[model samples]
Target: MNHLRVSGLRKRYGEQEVVAGIDLELRPGECFGLLGPNGAGKTTTLRLCLGLIDPDGGEIEVLGLPVPARAREARRRTGVVPQADNLDPDFTVEENLLVYGRYFGLRQAEARARIPALLEFAGLSARAASRIQTLSGGMKRRLTLARALINDPDLIFLDEPTTGLDPQARHLIWERLRQLLNQGKTVFLTTHFMDEAERLAHRLAIMDRGRIIAHGAPRELIAKHIEPQVVEVYGDGAGRWAREFGQAHSERCEQTGETIFCYTHDADSLVHHLDQRSGLRYLHRPANLEDVFLKLTGRELRD
Candidate 1:
């Protein structure tokens, strides 16, 4: 059975169309990423898919169950890790899991039976007795992940799963997510970090202003939207170098802040020009998801 199906999905807030006619299909055991900037309706779409909020138009189904009609049943089989941590500071780590278990209609004995394995899975075996205030940020996040799995769900929803995490912590979370995917669990993820999406998502959709602009594997989207090579130059005289040499050498060039991005099919001539120049540093690399995001969404900041 398919993990999820959404067709002609739409949600509006007053006059603003937050989710404007979207459609999606997620296979079982696939990590489907939803990417967008602030106010792009990603969060709204997640709520809609879960039937937490009614859509303005369209249909939703989870595990062959019609949404909002049988949303409670669908949610019983789903685990959700929200963007923010809302763990109760009043409770200890183990207690937190046990309390969440009650919400899933699991008994105390049943919850206790699963705590040890869950703690071990989250690398929080020792922190089980600790209070929420006593744990570090990473520890808290790990605990939240463990709590989401308390129901032994078939599908998991992760909202910006690695936000504000250090590199090491993020990698650890990525590894855990990998393990879940390997276990044949369906993962629906929303994230702003393009690298995270590129690494975790089997296939992804990029949304802008409440609509999907691109959908494919990371490599496919990159190939379709960006040049083969990119050279980023910055430092003193970078602008002058870009104006004088970058335009002549690159197929396309863009200036953002103090950095100049040159997109080209071939970088040999560009590298030669950079080698001849002084007081400028540059990075030469293959075009990636971030390039596609910028090309489609623009580099402007969204609030």
Candidate 2:
């Protein structure tokens, strides 16, 4: 059975609708990714699911309980890592987890017993007594994640969990998340990083302008929406090259950046065509989540 189910979820603020008719399901032990540009309603959808805000329309069932009405109960089994670190600067790493555990009705003794494990899980065992202000950006993020897990939640919600972190920090978080999934915990996440989504999500949904534009496993989405291979040709004479290439391979050409990208199932055929042209540099690779996003949503700044 699905761990979380959302159907026709809608939310609006004043005259604007932020989320419109969104539907999704997350299975046990799965990492489900929500991808979108800013103001595309990814955060709004998460808030509705967590019952932080009431939805304007539709239904949300978390752990088999209807949301908002059963929000308190649902919250008991849920963990959340928001996009920003809302950690109190005055509190030490261990203090934050202790306080958060209290919100879930864990006794002081029980919270204390769990602190060591939680600290280790978040890679902050040595920094347990350190104040939040003294911690690095990555350390703070890890602490936030540790605090969320204090309740031993069955399902976790992470909003832009690895945003702005260095490569090492991101990988550490990813490794910890993978461990959770291996232990049968479900993770629901929103991120702008396509590589993160592709690496972590068992399945995902792409949102745009408050609606889901695509949904599936990362590989399946790529296979359905984009060609297996893309040949990108760049340089000053790219337009002329594109015109000439488009005449011979019109069905395969798409213009992005200062280059013409030829999409095809066979890379050799496209490479053969490009070989005849000079003053052009080319790269060939498999399609990815970013390619699908650009194809479906177009390349435009959301902000």
Candidate 3:
């Protein structure tokens, strides 16, 4: 059975619609990614799914329970890690887990008994006695993720879970999330990092203007929506290159500021042309998820 389902999901504020007619499904043990630029309504969609806010139109079912009506019950099977760290600075690492477990009706004794195992899983077993304020950013993030699992939820909602962290910290979280998937836990997450989505998500949806413009496995989306190869020509004489050789060799070309992107079935011709053009730095590579994203969303800044 699908772990989560949404059909024609929509929401609005005044005359402006933020989430419009979105349909999605997630299977067990998969990481599903929701991606969009700023103001594209990714967060609103998440809130609606969580039943924290009512949608103006459509249906949402999380864990086979209709949301809002059965939101409380569904939430018991769901874990949430917000964009910001909301850990209590006054509490110790172990104490924080114990306190959070109470919301799921876990007794103090039960919560305490789970603490050691949870700490070990998060690599915080040695720091269980440390105060929250003394922990590093990465440590705090791990604690937050650990706390979310206090109730042993089947599904987790991670909102920009690794934002602002160094590469090492981000990879650690990714590894742990992969471990969760191995154990058959479903993860639904939102992220601004295209690379992150590409690495972790088994499938993803791209939202724009409050609607899902595309959804599929990352590789599938790339193959369907973008060229197989790309030649990114930047620096001096880039615009001239686009005008002269772009249309002749490429299936599509897009110019954004100082860079000209040439999308083609093959990059041999473009690479040959670049070899002749001195001082023009160019990169020929297989089309990536970021290329597909920029193609669909435009290279212009959202904000």
Which structure among the candidates has the greatest lDDT?
A: 1
Task: Report clashes for each candidate as comma-separated counts.
Answer: 0, 0, 0
Candidate 2 lDDT tens digits, 1-303: 688999999998998889989999999889999999888899999999989899999999999999988989999999999999999777899999998899999999999999999999988899989989899899999889889999999999999999999999999999989999998999999999999999999999999999999999999999999988877889988878778654366346877668887777777866787787778888988888998988888877778
lDDT of 3 by residue, 1-303 (tens): 788999999899999999989999999889999998888998898899999999999999999999988999999999999999999888899989998999899999999888898898789999999999989899899999999899999999999999989999999999989988998999999998899999999999999899899999999999999999998899868988899887689999988888988999988988998898798999888998998888888888988
Q: With candidate 1 superimposed using the best TM-score fit, by how many Å does residue 17's alpha carbon deviate from the native?
A: 0.5
Give stretches of model 1 more than 4 Å off. Answer: none
Sequence-dependent TM-score of model 1: 0.98
Using TM-score, give the best candidate's number.
1
My TM-score estimates for the predictions, one after another, are: 0.98, 0.96, 0.97
Q: Where's the lowest-lDDT run of ten residues in candidate 2?
A: 244-253
Model 3: lDDT to the true structure:
0.92
Instruction: Extract clashing residue pairs from model 2.
Output: none
Clashing pairs in 3: none
Q: What lDDT score goes with residue 188 in model 3? A: 99
